[model samples]
Target: MSNPLPFLKNETPVNWFWVDVSTQNLRVMKAAHETVRYPISTALNGLGERRNSACTPRGWHQVRAKIGAGLPANAILRGRRWTGDCYDASRDPDENGHQDWILGRILWLSGMESGFNRGGYCDTFRRYIYIHG
Candidate 1:
């Protein structure tokens, strides 16, 4: 059996992926393909592992878990809880003053094979940050 996800192909050429925390962008590169880019959110002050703080970690990571497969974009999520509503960027952030919900797509990340990202200093999954559409 094979993995069903588009990004989870086995034997696919090894591609490099990186996220720039400062610019809130994700980039993926394959040998001959153009680098695909996506907008992302990081830690507000770039600190802490608590909920409600939009601080994205700075380091190397892989797409640990890709969720909401075949789901519509802009889906609403609260407390990791999915509400029936789908949201766009135009939506007001004030509605949920705390805790940015993971919607649309979820790439649950585990730290990479090296550096501060591997251990207690900065664990991606433990921080509870999720990327959405």
Candidate 2:
């Protein structure tokens, strides 16, 4: 069977975190290690309290859950299921009218502390959404 922990095998036992917003690129950081960054596209018309769908949330979050762990890279995902096809954003025409596709992997985010990003409107956990490749 394919190893689900593919990303973890290469590095030491360090914690990993990531940040992505509509305006900026995706940033992944591993504790005591170099950070990996990539450009991303967010919601176009701005969604939620963030006001702008393009604006990424600002706060502290943890990977509450990781999905599609062992799936092949670029595998199409919908409703969190693998469609058995690799996806290339640049090559595939946008069928959903959105340029973003959370594929291959998903990081479920949860707020760390209360008030700031925990409860109320700023809750990241309750607003759980998939983040893809």
Candidate 3:
């Protein structure tokens, strides 16, 4: 596998959250700690940092904030603000609906690297990308 991002220069990330687009998994790694991997579902639109693409952004990112704390499961959120309403998937599941169904908890991400995942149309923060549950 050739270098995906040449800017990385073969350097290893100390503590990072990596989302594998192909496997639909997110790997969490911390220094001196066991690596953990979680099954995740990315956008069906595919990968890109461009705004409004509905695609998952690439490159370095940091968890800017944690939302939906102390909130009940299936709580719906709009514009990162809780709508105070919950959508029960069991009752009225998406099942191929137009809505993205951003429910439960959300971990807002901000890009650390400029000109890639950050800045202009490539900005993930501006794109409203989140690790949502």
**All candidates: CA RMSD (Å):** 7.6, 9.6, 4.5
Residue pairs clashing in model 3 are none
Q: Which stretches of candidate 1 lie over 4 Å from their true place?
A: 1-13, 32-34, 47-54, 88-101, 113-115
Compose the digit string of candidate 2's lDDT tens values, residues 1-133: 7653343465544655544454457666667554877776665554443322343455556778888988987887777788887876465657886555667888777765566556786676666644667
**lDDT, candidate 3, 1-133, per-residue tens:** 9776565688866777778889898888797353998999998888888888999888778888899988888889888888989886465645675467778799999987788888998899988889997
Global lDDT for candidate 1? Answer: 0.63
lDDT of candidate 1 over 44-111, digit per residue (tens): 57754333445566555676777777767777766555687887656666655653656677767766
Better of 2 and 3 by TM-score: 3
- The numbered model that scores best in TM-score is 3
**Superposed model 2: Cα runs more than 4 Å off:** 1-23, 30-33, 42-55, 88-92, 95-98
Worst 10 residues of 3 by lDDT: 89-98
TM-score against truth, every candidate: 0.62, 0.62, 0.76
Q: What order do candidates take by TM-score, descending? A: 3, 1, 2
Better of 2 and 3 by lDDT: 3
Off by over 4 Å in 3: 1-14, 32-34, 93-99
